[model samples]
Target: MLVISSSCKLCCMSKSLTAWLSIGLLVALTNNAVSQTSHPNIVLIYADDLGYGDTSCYGATAVATPHIDRIASEGIRFTDGHAPAATCTPSRYAMLTGQYAWRQQGTGIAKGDASAIIQPGRVTLASMLHDAGYKTGVVGKWHLGLGPAEGADWNGKIAPGPLEIGFDYCFLIPATGDRVPCVYVENHHVVDLDPDDPIHVSFKTKVGNEPTGAENPDLLKMHPSHGHDRTIVNGISRIGYMTGGHRARWVDEEMADRITSKAVAYIEENKDDPFFLFFSLHDIHVPRVPHPRFVGTTAMGPRGDAIAQTDWCTGEILAALDRLNLTDNTIVLFTSDNGPVVDDGYQDEAAEKLGDHQPAGPLRGGKYSSFEGGTRVPFVLRWPAKVKANQTSDALVCQIDLLHSFATLTGQTLAAEAGPDSHNLMAALLGEDSQGRDHLVQQARTLSLRQGDWKYLEPGRGPAINKNTNTEVGVAPQAQLYNLRADLGEQKNLADQHPQRVDKMKATLGRVRSESSSR
Candidate 1:
């Protein structure tokens, strides 16, 4: 995740720690002896609310993203990359668990104060990698939530977070950028939270005289269209209440730079050894606040500016790898958590200033929508000398495949219980045969499935168009199916025209969801 580049001192300290950690890990690597499997440094750069066409290489013309585009130009750009789910938390769950997110009930938009989603003792990708002698770390955007089990102390151990799940170290946001308990969570505890000035958060009501966007419109720099209007921070009203932890509170603009710096430092310190870094970026999401230096960087208001900031963060990370001479050995996977949306809560001139900027590229729907735009996102893999450069892959891939792909790459054998839905996409990542899965299931909080060229949306009750943003949710009664190959826009529904195909897809989606649910 991209963070503002303002905190140089903190970055320097992190860099120092990384150097020692790298040495220590290298020593461990040497002592452990090389296993039968050859492991490479893995860095997954996950962007927030990024659409398929947001980057220049992906046909975006609104803002030139030379930095983000460089990944596609340098290595492989996936044409049909997708997030397992349309939202952040579910997509992340799929990535780590290698399973379809929809199978897990209520794996939709999680609240900021929601309890830990991933159960403790569940073998995750991080834990597997750690067991295989790779140092794992997650920086930024831990929307998966944090807790110390039921009725545990906040001042004590916060179990079932990143560290508990398998990451050796973690520096993450307690929830989302728009959510409350708006503080940095480094490993177990909230960063710099003074016991004297304890933090109290609430989404339902406010405890103090915290001015809300609903009541104090004059104090808000960006107005919320729906939800995301509560306690004010840095001139913007967020989604929940935050009473204390003033010193640890992060600046929205500098978020990108800070995350990038931490990611780079982690890489630099672990350059000589195998390490896994999940660099979750917070940009182009709600409350799009670009750094002052990048305020007017694009014509698309804060959204475009935030996209530019994301690109800049990408450039910094790539530069770090090049500087450390690990570009050739390190495998970098860059993709977004979900699709894009112009107006998600905040009124940042995103929709108004969006002059022909197709955030979803050629696809329909975005973000919360069940359309292709909600899950389809730009995915690029870069590994100099190891992966063929400037290549395009039409491999049908999903974030859920990462666990198995990484496991195969590292030659780690996981029990059947772990990553049951994950399939190895190692060949696809290496730019080998382009053909991916024959049939794939997709989600949008709602359970949807896509097989080859056909897309299916299960019968459900949901808004066809989000009234606040006007993005299609791809929901309909009597089961909707579309031939995506013929109509990328999904303007034509073929449920009546192609009943046989619809039945087949329905069966496929049902079987997949049911099997996973049973597991």
Candidate 2:
């Protein structure tokens, strides 16, 4: 109508199209960035007393841990992985706080009535993740202790525990299954506790009128081989004494099912949000009492049967993730607290029925030993979205580094004083790097250092062998050295041959001890 030319009309139309296309491209790029930066759900499955050779994937022919193997086949299996210590309490402590347990006094094997080891104000793995906008929950063994300096009230609220330390929620086995107060504590109170009955526990002296294992041997379904002979609950005697709270006490056979159910429920409830789950399993530990359905499933008696039970629990969790379509964005890690111990306390035919079954595989010593088997444990990590499948890594990874690694993953800054011993091995964990921690410290009754393939053990004063458990404690009157590449079992002592190396390692150990932080 205004006598405009055809070329002018075409130019205006082309410009309009280009402007619309630019807006569409901008919106698409923004969406892609948001998806990339979104945090993934983390699930850490911690197995108690599971050794490097305990699973079929790790070469245990007697036991087939299909569920554990599935994780291995799906992600990365670390051969040189280790726990923080050879003992339970120390290992758990280091993993959570990112500091070596040896730095703190009273971090020894906790009694059933021991006070809280981790204080409220201190930084913890859960606290760090929680601050990073993730809902954290720990469901299973929490042997780190509870209550205040005076100890927890078994009948009332147990304060200054997992909740105080930054966990949004907790369902815990206050101590080891073999210890007293053999009940589950959910959040702050003892689950299913009866107010009228009351509860009392003691490690020093006999408490209550409960019949002891030493006195009532005939009443026990499984007798103690050594020290676990105090309070009898559910026909099994445990370390320390406990009275009342019968309703809250957990049954030995039904424990696997009970705890697994709770863990699964937590995952389901928190599926909508970015969550961190610490699913600590109580399997293949002492007093290995598998359910009736799993009793005769293996030839290694209760121990092998318990391994099978552990696999089932793993399957349950995996199935839940699959059902909820959360598998792709979740990172799952499976590992143990320490090495294997065959007759820890109860008489469970773990030794006698053993036929060609090697718990620690080719590694020497176990549990409380200072040898390779003591600290070296099975570690598998799986992240379907970001990690490649069927990978095996020999990176020198330790549980202590989890705090710093996770902190890096969430893009949070840690205080200078926090995670003193923890290193950021995130690249190694994700299989992006092969070398992890040039040198690592392994703790048992004494301390040892691992630099590359060489190992150094400082001379310490203790029995060379644990007489009761029939295990090598790795104590001696002289310094010890070994090249793990040539001698995996630590059969050859090359200390005399390599005097200079021993001196260097000894000096390094001393330096580490003197320093306030190793990070």
**Per-model RMSD to reference:** 11.8, 2.4
Compared with the true structure, the alpha-carbon lDDT of candidate 1 equals: 0.82
- Model 1: residue 473 alpha-carbon error in angstroms: 0.4
The RMSD (Cα, Å) of candidate 1 is 11.8
Candidate 2, residue 516: the lDDT equals 90
lDDT of 1 by residue, 371-422 (tens): 8999999999987756889999988888888888888778788787888788
Candidate 2 residue lDDT tens string, 139-226: 9988999998999988888998989988999999998999999999999999999998788999999988999998899889999999
Cα error of candidate 1 at position 201, Å: 1.2
Q: Which candidate has the top score in lDDT?
A: 2
Q: Rate the local accuracy (lDDT) of all candidates.
A: 0.82, 0.92
